[model samples]
Target chain A: MKTRYSFGGDEHVYVEIDEEMSLEAFFIALSLRNAVAEAEIPGVTEICPANASFEVRFDPDVIAPEEIMARIRELEHKAEVSDKRLETRIIEIPVYFQDPWTHETLMRFRERHQDPTGSDLDYAARINGYDSVEAFLEAFHSQPWFVSMVGFVAGLPFLYQLVEREKQIQVPKYLRPRTDTPKLSVGIGGCFGCIYSVRGAGGYQLFGITPMPIYDPTQTVSYLKDFMVFFRPGDIVKWKPVDRAEYERIEAAVAAGTYTPRIAPVTFDLDAFNADIAGTNANLMEALNGI
Target chain B: MAFKVVKPGLSTTVQDLGRPGYFHLGIPEGGAMDRFALRVANMLVGNDEGAAGLEAVFMGPELTFDADTLVAVTGAEMPIFVDGEPREGWSAFVVKAGQTLRFGFLKAGARIYIAFGGGIATPLALGSRSTYPIGALGGIDGRAIAAGDVVPVGEATTMTERSLDRSLLVPVSAPVSLRVLTGLYWHRLTPACQARFFADEWVVAPEADRMGYRFRGGSPMEFVDREQPFGAGSDPSNIVDGCYSYGSIQVPGGQEPIVLHRDAVSGGGYFTLGAVISADMDLIGQLQPNTKVRFTEVTMEEALAARAARRDRLAKLRAALA
Candidate 1:
């Protein structure tokens, strides 16, 4: 795809690979970010990779904005043929669907939703042609998701389903963003799934809540002891739905600092995955269950 | 040396140049909103340009010093008081042990910078003393200063008092015009809306904060209808989630346009029409609520020239102080 490069004021260069979101577009953005970082270009301060595009923030005094754009264009050319294999880890995130916390939060913001009469999960299930919320929930947890980008807020991961485009589940954001979203609320908007890393204003349609701490700046959690952010751009996430009782048990464990996330390292080959999407996902899940 | 906060004014926090390179992880490069003012405050006290200092908004903190120290206050135009005796802004002054520093109502500007001789000695998080309150990182316990908090200060590296000439100061005035370089998703808006964006006058909304500033009182913008892209929301103003640059202006539903600031979210679904130039972001920081502003569009060349001009002014300020 032909990428569009635009300057963000005087300090940043935004490169949009595609108008639509896709794994291919994400890979291209990732490769470009990696290539620019490896080049050790001076004055380039931050390389932010996103769902279908990426941004590079630079110091204009050290390197002219045009010069950085020229270098990035050159780097993009080189990245076209680079290796596509990503060595990443798969993590199991325990979530309690239809949990009371998110349910109450969503109910309060129903005036801003497309369907105020029904819950977010029910509305999503109906629009996606599901007979019941249970069937939709099954479809959601059965497939693993790719951590396409980690942003919007500190440690928040935007997840893309591993399934093909035709089978992708999509939903629109709130008509107007709600002023409040409970922290750790598992929500979906458009074709992306996310966990609110902190309590703040949000627009996503909340369906569940995650007991695990995906972000901890103090590094208090055992799983996040080494790093404050639990999810990286290349990480794969598997949603494991649990009952309310299990959610409380895990929540208690998390509060006591005894929770350890289930993680397993795996290699993701873009070409191989593209060739056999279902087969590749099954293999990846096998690795996760084996751990 | 240290200072005891007898009264923590409306949201005071420690800040420097902030920690960069973490925006990818969704952590904003948070720091003093009025960076030029912070740099000047530090320079007046003989501290490093990026040294940590107190960034107070609307009001100033009542701090009592434990030891004699040189200090300077900048950014907002407010009355500075030392033990009930009026002092001066934009100049370094001596605060003896047990003397309390205070301020009167803010006369102009929204935020103020207070720099000590050796800078605030807050522990660094991600190599910065700047506070990212949303992420609970840096500053005093990763939050704003409160009453009774004993703020620490580094040992006095230099004790000389220096002041900037009144003429050198960047004046905060009404109807501030911010230069914008339109890009990112500028094509999404209608031509009339695009024209209206620049032609309309906007007032700073009360919702303004470190994360972003919202501007209202302008005619609601209209978007050119199109087939919504896959994975994007149905709203005409929504796009596939993407990265947001510092100073990027996002107009959700074409209503109030919000300009993301220092502690902005790294990425979001709302479309950004353009970004306010880096040269004028400091001015935005000093704008108070109800302040009228205009978004003036500029070409890339003009934006670069403005940046160069700002750098030259900073150099002149540094030289004058020296």
Candidate 2:
């Protein structure tokens, strides 16, 4: 892949690993990101990894911008040939599909959507060649997704499907952004799936709301006790569609500080997964079920 | 010591140099919008340069100090008054107990940094008192100051009175020219649009805030035609979700360019044409609503030179105050 390096400003250097978004592009960016992190270069204040690009913010007073760029170029070359195995966690997040909250929110912003009359789920299902919402939901939950990036808000994970590019679900964002989005609303814009970490402006087509709290400044939840922000880049996520009652049960448990997110530790090898995509995904899902 | 907020101004928050190292978590390095002014106020009050101070936007807060302490107000040309008596801005003075510090309507600029002798003692949420209101972290319960709130003040180790030289202050005027280093998806814009972006003058819209400053009145930019990539939006200006650099300018729909600022969202789908250089960001913070501005393109080398000049100027400011 041809990596293009550009200046964000005097203090930031932006590195684009590829012109398009793909798992290969993300891994290349991640490899470079990990290398830069482990190198512990002085004056580097932030190392932000995105879908197919990464940006480094540094204190120019401590290190010159040219020097930082040179160091990053050298590191990128090394990262391209490095091992691509990621030891991460597969988290099962329970979602109440077509929940009333997100449904109401999406209805209010229908004018901004492509199919204003139909529900976001119905529209997405129709466009993705699924006969019904159930089939669409099945396809969504069948494969685990990689957390390609974690941003746009605190703890909000942007996910890309682990399946091959031919099977990727592609959708366009709203023509204009809506002023409001229900917090924890599971939304998809383009091919990335994201859970809205906060209630604010959004343009993604909302499908449902998650009962789990992915973000909390006050670490009230047991699982979030160690870190207020729950999601991280490279984490895998599996969706578990739940009924309203189950969603309410988890919500109450979360409020009572007794709920812990379902997480299973896994080592993901890029080469192995590339070789046998279906078998690899089945094994990953089996691991989640075993946990 | 503590100071009671007699009347909270429009959007007042405690801020410092800001908390870095959290951008990857989607938390911005939010602090005072006018960082240079904040630093000057801190220096005048004998506090650390990164000390927490009050950043009041548009209006001034009515604060009553419980104890006698030094204070300085910088940025914006607002008239500072202590118990109805006027005091000089950009200079440190004592505020006695039971006296109230207030201000008249803003004469110029947008934000004012008020530094107490000892910085605001708000509990740190992420190693800094700077408030990121969206994330609800840091600074007075992670929100802007309100009436009846009693904000704590740190102990002043060494009180001092200092005044900044006129040249040291940030200069603000109507129709400012902001230097931008155009990169990162700049190739997406047509040559005509790129030339027009620099040729046309723009005005700051009311949407300007800590998160970003939206500029209007510029000719709508046109993007080069291309087959939309998978996962990217259909709009010509839209790209796949990616990281937004601080000061990055993104024009959704190829109109109304918005420059991401201190409290910017880390990543999004909007394609950024380029970013305003760091040296010019402080000026963006000082711009008032409807302020006319122009975008002037510069090379990376020129941007770095400007940054170095700014650093030298700040060093001079510190030495003069010292």
Candidate 3:
């Protein structure tokens, strides 16, 4: 796909890989960002990859925006996501769907929702053509989600589903923003999903809760010893639904420093995936087994 | 030597240029709101342009010095006093050992920055001393100053004079014009809303702070609505969550426009108008609640040229002081 490049001021250049949010578009953006990062262009401070787009921040005093723009255009043509030799981790993240904590929070903010009379899940299911709320939750966790960006707040990640566009779950954000969302709460708005690392104002539709800490300021967890944030752009998060008893068990384990995320390494081939999404997803899920 | 805060005043925290290159981690480029004022204050006391300084807002602090040193207060205008004698702001002055420095309620402007002869000797976090209050990781214990707090200071590094040329610095007055480059998401806004955005005079809302300056007294912004794209939220203000360029103005609910600042959040789902040019960020930084301002649209070339002019002015200010 041909990328559209636009200036974000004198210091930043924004590139839109495609207008639509497709896995192919994300791979293209991610590939270009990785290629740009490896190039080590002078004055390039940050290369931020997003959903279907990316941005580059540079010191224009050293490298003019025009120079960077020309270089980016040249790089976009050469950077390849085909047969992409990617190294990434697929992490098994345990989630408690429709937990009491999020249930109460969503109930209190019903006025700020599209359907004030129904629960967020009930409304979501009806809008998405699911037979029941249980069916919606089942479909939601049927496939893994890919981390498209890690921002909005520290350690918070925006994830998009790995399934086809028609199969993707969609929901609107709250009619008005909520003053607070609980820490570690899982939220979905439109086609994107996020995990709130801390208690703060949010506009996403609340759905579930996670037991593990995605962000630790003290870096107490061994896995987060080097960096406080757990997820990065291009990481895969496999949501595993759990009951209250299992959620409490995992929560206790996490607190005692005994919990370790189940992670698997895999290479994503963009060309192969585009050719046969079902076969590729099956392969990717197969690689995730026994890890 | 150090200074002890007798009364920390309203919203006093140490700030410098800021920490860049960490926005992807969701960390803001937290720094002085009025960056140009901080630079001038630092230059008046013979410190590096990026030296850490105190940013006092709405009110001023009363401090007792442990040793004699030179200090310059910039940005907001306030009457600085040594013991009992009055001292001038926007200029350098001497503070003797054990002498107390205080101020009256703010006469004009919203915030004032004071640069000590030697920079504030706070330990750097992520390569800066600027305070990010939300993150709780930089400046004095990663928070605001409090009574009895002894802020560490470096040695008296250089000699100092009274003030810079009056014309070299902005007077920090109200009704400032913010030059904007309307290109980031210009197509998303309806043409009528775009016309109203530039034609109206916006008043600084009372809830303004370092994160963003929310403005009132403008025609509500409306977007060119259609079937909301995937990943974008349902609201008219919604877009696929993307990078929010520092100084990008977002009007949530179409009620008021909030211009992101030095502590700007890196990304959001709102449809942004455009970024306030770097040259005029200082204008909004000094604006107080109820201050009227107009957003003037300019081309990207014009914005870059304005930045060049600002740099030339800063160079002149540095040379004259040298």
Candidate 4:
């Protein structure tokens, strides 16, 4: 069942539906098509979607805000009730951290106060079990993670989130602030991990890079689009690392049309997922002690 | 039939309606800044509303017509001449093959529209001829018009002299006042700041283009530096950059109003203080440097009415043409 709610003298409307429907993307797309067809506005513009919200631009002369809201509600209801399953594609990207010292520095800093006689060093040594740094780098590089690249600028692609444990990796706030960050650097910042496509003033910490070009204007749809990064709410992902040699090999295979990113099949129950979210929020609050 | 560009203006490009259905990929709807003038020029030459035309900015171009063609120049007051004869603007005239069309200084406004009976024959890129120069998409070579470039003309059905009317021409020199509606963030402004915004006049700053137009005003608008993230499922902060929407008054860092234009980005960072009503976009486009502009707030009802009136006026003109 779908429920319709109106706000701001009908300037805005939202349709809440049973979680079973999983039709948010469909509803948004339908709204856009209906706005273009039913509203006789001159140059009706549609804003790119941010998160789950998408906006359509119309000439108020042709259709009132109330009318637009009404149409959206109608479309949302129809989409919610429709018995169609949307097709989604998943993609895997391999990341490589060129500098091992960054992780080593973090590990050493975390252990310094705990063990005056280097007992923590044993723990660190246990964690670093590989014969050599090169062996560790190679071993870590084989894991694949799901990534969604969204926007493009200057032949570079921008992504949304890095998924883990059937949910997005929630990044904690930075301990110390850095003013500038480099492009293609992946880092976690405030509940999200992102890959910076270009050098700019940013907050995320530097992690690593993937051999795949973020964007290439020369290609018909660009590699970002070819990867099928189209994402919806409630998707799951995991991260995998790769070495520079393997990255180059994968790049070559992609160029030769022989490589495809590994994807994991996803299945979920909407009610159960929503319940999990509620329980997780409660737990988070309890753990934080009402901070 | 084509035209040879002798001297392209500061940032001239070919434009028509715009590209659609690609916003999910971060492409902008690149089109004419002053759509009213583009329509008028198209109407004069018996072309469809979305026919490709020239959007010459800041200055005009010196060109030589390769074939006998009926053309009209509209938008902004530029001193134009044909074969050294003083040429009247806004009206269509036949240019004989091999005749030269030269433009002098720009008297007012930033962009001028030039429409030929046969529109420019540039290949449709992403369903538009409008140039998105930043992305190198659409128009001739995905860039502004330059000297020594030859643009081909499309096939056009020649009309009889009876179809041409001098009365159909739109006056290019008239001063325009734009109507506006307060947007979602309008109330975020302090009462005193709002009062100052409405009371004082603003001038078009030197930094104005298809992407955005910055205004020189009495005082800057300040806002709390809250960490406002782009809404859900949005691009990372950087790729989704630049202006958006006509009349979208963006105050980045609580200073200088950057009014977005036709070729604005899909999403942006700055606080969108206001969006100008659709009907007033052309009026805003016609403003010249140092031109005084007052920001008058109108109710949503008034905005709708103004939009209807503007549409009705255009419909009447189209009916007259029919």
Candidate 5:
């Protein structure tokens, strides 16, 4: 596939090796470079992901819209060739599942979606291809996807993606977010799981608690590293239930500094974020000129 | 020499030019909220522009000099008295050992800048003497100035007395006008809304701070409904929560515009409607709550010209001082 993109009067042309190319990633890289190059341009800024995605900023005057689109199309092609398969790794994270009401609410939700013959646990196990619900629950304690949490001081948010029974479960938005969500809350909202790092008002559904400290200003490195986000675009994830003892072990490992966080494979292009912006800018310009 | 703080006022903190280039790690560029006043005070004290000073918020402080020290006060128009004798603003003064410096209520403006002949010597964090109140990173223990805390002053030698430019003293009673440039999401507003933005005036909101100055009274502008974009790990709904470079104006809900200042976050998720011109940031800093502000959009070229003009002015001032 071939795609042409432009932004800020800059032209970018690129080819895609496969339809699987992730536009977000491609643009990110392009934007980062452009933002850096145009630092001197008023209103132009760029953000670079030392580890995840690339970003760029530009002054509209420094580059033409068509030029940005061309760069996007060109970068998309480069991303496709270097594309890596989406992979998921499970590392056990110990969480206390605070506030019994939160668990009750999640259990009720599971029952609402489960088949009549199976318990909520059975349904969850079946979705991940477990022969027995108990076994699946046991394994869950040893492995959990590390969600990406981002926010301000003591304010962290995690993103999660799960797949089951060849059907994608869409997480809904919170009908009414609480004025203050508790810290370490396992929340499900809008097709993702989020762990609240601090006490703040939020709407995501609470599932459980993880004793892990997601944010600590005193620490040298934060809990959320560049590469360890739970979901990155196309990666598939599943939740496994773990018992209290197993959870404790993982917690100890985290505290002892014995656990090494595994990095999730890159499934999306890091360059497409800029390309998409570039492409959109070009299209807007073209439509304006009736070309 | 050291000065003991008798009263720390509303929100006083040690500040400098701010720490820069560490946004990726989620650190803020915390410095004097009012750079204009800070710079002028520093210049008067024969300190570098980036020298650490005191940022007195709202009401001013009551301090006593433990030893003889040279000092200058700038920024807001707060009455200053040495041992109960009123003094003029902008001119350098020497206080005898054990002399008390008392400040009266703020007559105008929100912040006051006070600089010593020798800058305050505080521990540097992330390469700045500015205080990041949220992270508790810089300043004296990452907290605001407290009563009884003695601040150390650097070594200094007395210089011959010279007259200061009287015209440079900004009037406290008058309103300040700020220059602005349209930002990334400026085009997202409707044509009529865009036109109204420049035509209308805004008032400084009560919720203003070092992080940003929130404006009130402008009609809300609407943009196309879109999912909130992600920023550097802060609030997904507010882009300014992440990292905001100097002069970025982030408008949340297409309503109130928050002008990011020296203590602003490194990145953010809010829709940036426009940025105040760099040269005009000082003018904006002088504006206090209830101050009427009108935003006039300028082109990128105009912004550059303004910046060049500021640089030239600074050069001239430095030459005159030399």
Candidate 6:
């Protein structure tokens, strides 16, 4: 990996693990960040691991920026991403495709959209060479996505499909951002998929809505008791297509505080995944079973 | 014990040192824009530097105290008054019970810090009382205090009036030069853009707020034309989504360069050009709309030296007060 290192002023050091986004690069970034976090170097304030890179914020008063950069470089060299079995959880996320709230929202911001006349899903499918929206939906749900980054907004996870570059989905963002987006709105911009954590401004192409809350300030969800946000940088997310009945049922369960995401312990083997993509996906699906 | 809000200014909210270490969760460090002034105001009231205080922007709030309390104002030069009597800025004064504290026009700077002797006493969220208005987190009811709102002030020991030295204040004026360190993606831009960035005088856009300040008038930058990566958008100023540093300046559409402030989304996909050095971050809050700004390039060593200088100056101020 030809990793590039630079200073984000005196307080931060940014390391670009790779110039492009790939699962291989993501694993390396995750491993390197884990090592850095375990090292617990003093003056290191925040460790943010992104899709294909990582950044560290530190107090230069306590430790020189160059010294901290050296520590990170050494950690990068020591992180054996290829050999280590990456600990990850597969979370089953339910989405109601073309849900009423998000459909209304996407319609409301049509003027800001690239194809104002067509719906976001129709435009996306056409651009991606899919004959119909159903085909696009099938392609989207065929494989699980790796949570590469969790940011832009609190609890908003940037998920990339667990597939080769040629098989990945791509779409441009809105020409101008919408003033408001429905909460828990599922959206995709460029090649990354995301869930809107809060209802505010958004530019992503809205596709659906998720009943389960990703961000809860009140900490109502049992899983979110410790922290409001659920998704982490390296977590694996699989979308389960839900009907109106199932969506309403899940909504009821959420309101009753009895629902939690179905999560299963899994080890990510990048080498194995690269070798047998279909086999690895089958294993992941088998592993991810219950709440 | 509390003050009744007679009039809420353009924007006034409770702020403190902020809750750090949560950037990974996309939580911003939404605190006082001018932390130095906030600390100074807190110190004047005999409170810890991180104590919660009121942060007023553009204009100042008018309130009537329910009880006699010690209060101090810092940052913007807004003429404050007790019972219609004008008082000087950057000073701590006592306001008797039922006396109305009114604010006049701001002569300079964009934001001001007002500290009650005992602190604002807003409920702490994730370890700070600072408000993130967009997310509706922290501060009073996760929003700015409005009319008829009674904000509880903590207990405090009143003292004689005190004023800070003129040297301690940040002079708010046009043509402010902000020291910036070249960013991670600066190399991706054409050399002409890099040269134009510093040569041009950027003016603060009217849309500037705590989330970010948009600067217009800078020459549009051109990215090195290349095949766009998978996730990176087709736009020249687009890149693979990544974590953004606080103070990072991202230029979208090569038009207005937006510098992210303390109350901002932690990470985004926009291409960053540079970041304001830590020493100059607080001064960003003092920049009013239409203020001319130049991004002066500085090395990390120089940035550290400037930070040290500010720290030394603050230490001296603390000693002088003692």
Query: Clash totals for all models, in order?
Result: 0, 0, 0, 8, 69, 0
Classify candidate 1 by CAPRI docking class.
Answer: high
State the interface C-alpha RMSD of candidate 3: 1.6
Best-to-worst order by TM-score is 1, 2, 6, 3, 4, 5
Residue pairs in collision within model 3: none
Q: What lDDT does candidate 5 reach at residue B92?
A: 74
Q: Write the per-residue lDDT of candidate 6 for residues B1-322, one digit (tens) a residue.
A: 9998999898899999998978888888889999899999988878888899999999999999988888899998889999999877778889999999989999888898999988988788899999887767898777898989999988886556788887765465457999999978998788987999999999999988888999998788877888887688888788889889989999876778999998878777788887999999999988899999999999888999999999997898798676
DockQ-best of 2 and 4: 2
DockQ of 5: 0.09
Estimated TM-score for each candidate: 0.98, 0.97, 0.92, 0.69, 0.68, 0.97
Return model 5's CA RMSD, one decimal. 10.7
DockQ-better candidate, 2 vs 3: 2
- Cα error of candidate 5 at position A246, Å: 9.8
Better of 2 and 6 by DockQ: 6
Quality of candidate 5's docking, in CAPRI categories?
Answer: incorrect
Pitting candidate 4 against candidate 6, the one with the higher lDDT is 6
Give me the displacement of residue B31 in model 1, in angstroms.
Answer: 0.4
> Candidate 2, residues A126-222: lDDT per residue as tens digits?
9999999999989887799999999987878999998998888877888889999988999888899999998898988888889998888877678
Q: What is the lDDT of residue A25 in candidate 4?
A: 34
Candidate 2 residue pairs in backbone clash? none
Off by over 4 Å in 4: A1-48, A59-62, A71-87, A94-291, B159-178, B222-246, B319-322
DockQ of each: 0.87, 0.78, 0.54, 0.12, 0.09, 0.78
Q: What 10-residue stretch in candidate 4 chain A is worst by lDDT?
A: A7-16
The DockQ-based order of candidates, best leading, equals: 1, 6, 2, 3, 4, 5
State the interface C-alpha RMSD of candidate 6: 1.0
- The TM-score obtained for chain B by all candidates, in the order given, is 0.98, 0.98, 0.97, 0.88, 0.90, 0.98
Top lDDT hit: 1
Candidate 5 CA-lDDT value: 0.57
Stretches of candidate 1 off by over 4 Å are none
Model 4 has an lDDT value of 0.56
Query: For candidate 6 chain B, which ten residues in a row score worst on lDDT?
Result: B166-175
